[model samples]
Target chain A: METPTYNTAFAELEELVAQIEDKDIQLDTLAEKVKRAKELIKYCEEKLRGIERDIEEVG
Target chain B: MPTPKKLSELVNEIDATIRNRFVGQAFWIKAEITDVKKQPDKRWCFLKFIEKDRNLITTEMGGVFWSNSYNQMENFEAATRQQFASGLEITCLVKVVFHKRFGMRLEVMEIDFAYEVGKLENERKQILERLVKEGIAVNPEGSSRYYTQNNTLEMPMVFERIALIASANTDGYRDFRKVIENNKYGYHFSVTDFSTQIQGDAASALIVERLHSIYKLKEQFDIVVIVRGGGSDTDFKSFNDFELAKAVALFPVPILTGIGHDRNTSITDLMARQHKTPTEVATFVIDYNGDFENAVMQLHDRILVTSERLIDRARRSLDTYKRIIASSSPETIMNRGFAIIRSNGKIVVDAKDIAVGAEIETIMKQDTILSTVTQKQDNGNTNI
Candidate 1:
């Protein structure tokens, strides 16, 4: 699967948080939701900090 | 042509005639100081003054401040808190002198500091009025379309790409780079510094050109920042240019300004999101990204807490269902002194359905007995 953008990752994390808070969510899907949430958080943190060291100067 | 006058004699004649008109007479004159140079002796100040006609310098004159006059001017500056520098509009009392060698020049006698300040204030007010009339200034009723256009743009979750406009070797640019590069969060910024003249005659045009270039590559940048280090009020005058202000106001991307003047807001400052200094602008970017990071951190905590709670809830529910099922098992019921009777391959539920001498099976928890029924019982009466 392709990596999600920061906004997409954040949105997914929020949805996962909401689903986990839901009382009607099935136990079978609980683990799946938690795993996905963790993945999104990692993707977001990497996107936030990942960049080259030098600043590019334009005219 | 008359008498073929000598060059020196004609020059002397002209000087006498000019002196006849201006000698020993003082008049108050209003003009801008285009340049000022202090002599090595520290007692004399030479200045070039110019009269501007609608942004064009139409006339020029030289002026001198002798030691006695310079001392008086210093006292005036101390009282009025305004410095005599280039780009200052001043009304000074001067006596015109036609020198034998240096030609015509004004001799400084006194300065009207209050008048200069009032003139600047008037000019600022006029510019503000023009901006309002042009429908570009912030509306008092909170409905200015142009002033609020760039403000309505959503800041990116992470400021990955930034378009920075500042002089190449300025303290402001250095300070901004230092703060952003050394942010404690380790956030990375892809800064593209568009070095340009930050202040001076060419500053406004250069800044406007940079803005256009950024607009062409607008998608490549997240935000545009214009910053400058501390300078005199004259140096900041370029920021008040109408063209630069208009460009910033109508910029497609969000523009932030840190021109480093805390007292008065420049036209560019009014058009863009203004900060006190370049460092503050960098701090704003850092804090902007930090907010999203903090939010993500909060969400991470929530997910962890909620997942654990959910798993614990599911476990307790499963345990309860398991207990209920175990308690109602057939073996458990049968172990409590009950027997299940079977006849003709089916459990007999009613006694009337079976006749005497019928073959049957009695099943208990540990044993099953094959027997024949010799009696039929109904409600406390037995028939054999």
Candidate 2:
């Protein structure tokens, strides 16, 4: 699978928050959902922090 | 018709008559240059001068810049940074000379620098007017100079991939690279150089070609940047080209110009999405990325805070349920001074539930006691 973009990661975070806020969520998976949300947040934060990209030259 | 004169004799007579009338005379005249060529291994140049009525050439004359006067041509180019080539209009001092074989020619003496500059300025005005008339740009009003389709394009939210149009040798290109590479925010971008000449007569065509190349792969770029080193005002002449300006104005992707002039804005600059010095353009990109990062970080913070609040609320709710369950236990109720009476195997809550002679067990927090029901009492209350 392709790596998620920052926008996509943020979107996933929002969805997770919705699930967490809803009373219908099972308590059994609450911790697991929170952990996944934190992971997505980290992924987005890393993307923002700079990674070097190759500089290409063309005619 | 009358006794035909020999060709040489007629030419000599004509030349003598020409010299007799205008010998040792110099005149300042306005003419357009054409077919200019420098003699090989010699400090002399030959060219043609023409006078035009509208676009039609009315008169033409051969002209020369002798070795002694060549420095004047050099000085003109130095001052204007414009090529002293064909199509250039100049007010120049010339001496009319006539020879039997060469016929009539003018020896160029001096060129008017201000006149050439004025001509260029006039052309610039015409180009700007044409752009507005053609609906390519809005008429600049007040402080706003240009409003074009390209300028109206929305910049990408993140400038990660860039198509860079600039000469590889220019200091502007180096400065831009240094700034972007060393940015404090460490925002990295994929800059692809579409190297091309940034000045001279052919620069506009080369740049326009580069823009075309970028168009083919438009999806790969977030924006296109054009930059050149700082130089004389005339050094930025190509950027004022109408064709280049039109290309920039109509480009599908946003373009940025950093031609390095503070006093004058080129037509390309007016049409582009942003115009700044090379270093400043780099800085702007960095800042743009920084802003996006800040927004993302803020969103991260919000999500973190909200999720924590949700988990904390869940925990508190669980704690409340635990307390309620513990407090509602039978032992807890009995500890608060209530006894549970059991008849046989069931708890008795009403006087009618027990017979007059039935045996009962009373359960309390600390002890259980066996007892017998001696009588039945009638009371209005029946609910336990």
Candidate 3:
């Protein structure tokens, strides 16, 4: 699979999170979507954390 | 007298004579036609009359009106000031017949037009007033307070398997079933009508019987429709009881009421999730579900569009990042005659990888350089 773009991956992560949170989503589909959302969240969080640490160290 | 037949024959003859004495006699007695149904031969008017219930048991009698009597009563009721329903009390002259095989029957002959009154309606209204006072029949404003909690619908498309809490075999049950099935979305309906008598002493019992059955199979339907033909409020008073009201309110699914009466709202109606004046709860069902379906579809569409847009944004950004990475690739740098060099199998930076007496190598864009180390330096202090 092609690696996701730095910016686009975060956007997809947000989208997946939103889908999980939406109340109207079917109950049966919640678990799988939530798992995917967590993975995306971690991926996005890792990227953001690295940037945060770099900024802190430079300052 | 001497030529009279055996005792059995004489007794049977007397019984026949007594029955014939009242067969065609015209007399007026007060009554109301609770159910007026058209049959193949003639219209059958189900009649009910209270005879003071001598033992305090409210008595009811059925009267069949073939044709002439039906027309008369129809016209009389239409022209009269009082309603011709269950709670309606009226004065009429009925030709009472004691059929040898069919027991007592009444053939209404003449209606005392001036005798019709508002006694039944008033009684029913008074009962309603009492129920209201008892806090059982809550007004609309008061009812709204009970709905302050959040109520989001879980099931999207509810399977409507209706059990019409009506009698086993009656036109009231059949007519109710027909009217509900008349609409377009009628194809998916599964209505099992327990045919029941509309108005009589048996009326309340039959209603409770049907209600019991529907309540038993509560999981099969989202709501139960208790429907009957338009008739006396008294005929359907079983629906107004606190027991029935509680049954409906506490039912697994919501109970819907289509019990007939345009102007009068029963305690059952107040307890139900929805109420319609006539025997067409499907109208309310269709409208309610239609609104629900529309909202769900809108939300579903929103989910799809938003997901697609997000995924698309992700894909486009990935494409741009790939392009930048490809531009800075090792093959591109090598083709430009630049090289990544190492000395003694390690990348050369500050020449530390070179040992004082060892051979060193360098990789250039086009060639390799080999040399022997002849100098040593520590923190810029050199020994040569």
Q: Over all chains combined, what TM-score does candidate 2 have? A: 0.65
TM-score of each: 0.70, 0.65, 0.53
Stretch of 10 with least lDDT, candidate 1 chain B: B321-330
True contacts kept of each: 0.00, 0.00, 0.00
lDDT of 3 by residue, B1-384 (tens): 468687667557766886677655687676545544445255656555655554463666767665766766666555442335555556777776665556566767666655542543455556556655665554455343121011112332653677667654554566666656775554466877666774555555666676677767767766566776554343445555655554554455556666766655655666664455434566666666667678888987786666556655655654553443343444444677766556647655556666687777756666777877789867666643
Per-residue lDDT tens digits of candidate 1, residues B141-224?
654333646655677788879999998778889999999999999999999989998877789999999999999999999999
Among residues 3 or more apart in sequence or in different chains, the pairs in candidate 1 whose N, CA or C atoms overlap within 3 Å are none
Off by over 4 Å in 3: A1-59, B1-117, B132-135, B140-159, B167-187, B230-252, B273-279, B349-360, B364-384
Model 1 segments more than 4 A misplaced: A1-59, B1-27, B32-44, B49-61, B66-89, B95-105, B141-146, B231-233, B377-384
How would you encode candidate 2's per-residue C-alpha lDDT over B7-92 as one tens digit per residue?
Answer: 99988888888888888889999989999997736989999999888999999999999998897887787666566789888899
Interface RMSD of each: 16.7, 15.3, 20.1
Which docking class does model 1 fall in? Answer: incorrect
**Which docking category, incorrect, acceptable, medium or high, applies to candidate 2?**
incorrect
Q: Which has the greatest lDDT? A: 2
Report the C-alpha displacement of residue B206, candidate 1, in angstroms.
0.5
